[model samples]
Target: MADTQTMPVALVTGAGRGIGRSVASRLSAAGYRVALTARSVEDLAGTAAECPGETLVLPGDITDPAFVDQLYADIEAAWGAVSVLVANAGAGVSASVVRTTDEEWQRMLDLNLTAPFRCLRRALPAMVERRHGRVVVIASVAAKIGEPYISAYTASKHGVLGLVRSAAAEVATKGVTVNAVCPGYVDTPMTDATVRGIVEKTGRSEQEARSALASKQPIGRLITRDEVADAVLLCVTNGAITGQGINVDGGAVPS
Candidate 1:
């Protein structure tokens, strides 16, 4: 068994809650030294508390390039180059193509696409040089199939998946692996927010809104956070699974 000093280091963005929090805790329990970052200090602390292994809490906006750069530097200064990176920081905006404003479109792109791109770029050099790394971005089923009222979110997710595929190919010869975990509507706070939107727009009861989302999945239920984390773990352990978008969407989009 690897000692604490020799355990791999993992950095998880948007580690405050939802899938990010679950992934961070899962990595920690898997014997990784995790670094948690999000906009909320309290939430980061909450995630850190659940981690049985060592943890570093770094709270900041990943959409800011400066913050992304500094977090990598701080991680290196503390635990060394990141052996695993989960770019799970992202936001979804519900809007039609015509109704989507410039600000909303840009925000989706910045958080979902650009932020992951920046993190992937920063992590590659050290990983390639050391010839060891794993990168998994938490994307969505919207990336594969388009649905109504989410033009910006779908586009951004599509872009991130593309980024993952291209980056994985570039680092394939090296020991580093890059992949994306595309899940359907997960039972998370983010999904709760989406339900609220449905309530406001369609006058559907909160339960109805949630059930509608669940019905979209052929499994007739929402995907759990742990399920998504399992996919990330698969990517980390299997070196041959790079450049693929592993769907945890309960057979929603058959590939």
Candidate 2:
């Protein structure tokens, strides 16, 4: 539980846009000093400008271990310790196993799995010492179900859930909670690209392509970025959400 007198600091990766941006903004509104990290300096700066409290833009490739170490070092030097870490920097690369190259497979695993692991490892020691921390990994619905042409993306997300579950169990008694949020078809740049891919394949209008994807979900439309952000906020602020993967997929996934 957070003390009312001491405002917590949150480090959000991929905070440039979409759900990550919304989560970072929401945390700031809730009185957390935010440290925004992304590969794009301009986009991170834009997000920082919208935040309510002190915001630091730390732009670097999260997949690079050296860059990750430097990121934590900078945070430790400036803020002493971070109270929250949102591992939201991930991407989807679609290709069947037979067509997937080793580079593609490794890239997905590096960004989606290993990067989060690195961030968690760096933050755990400080959080354990303080007896307070919230670690949220933003995974995807593909983790639970089979998605065609996206084997690497699915595998990486599944690995994310495994990491969250194992780490949460280890840190539960130490006042740190680790959790994963799985969102489906959120209206983001990622979805836009997916829609474009559909359009190219079917020669359909963008709206039609988007609709085709959205119709697969039980809900009639794609989930909004803010909706996903809300789920992350719940995980970060609640003490009892450890070792869980809360799905915000508009009921796309069955319980």
Cα RMSD (angstroms) for every candidate in the order listed: 1.0, 2.3
TM-score of each: 0.98, 0.96
Report model 2's TM-score to 2 decimal places. Answer: 0.96
Judge candidate 2 at residue 11 and give its lDDT.
97
lDDT of 2 by residue, 100-202 (tens): 9999999999999999999999999999999999999999887788878999999999999999999999999999999999998999998999888888877
Q: List the residue pairs that clash in candidate 1.
A: none
After superposition, candidate 1 runs with Cα above 4 Å error: none
In candidate 2, which residue ranges exceed 4 Å CA deviation?
Answer: 1-5
lDDT of 1: 0.94
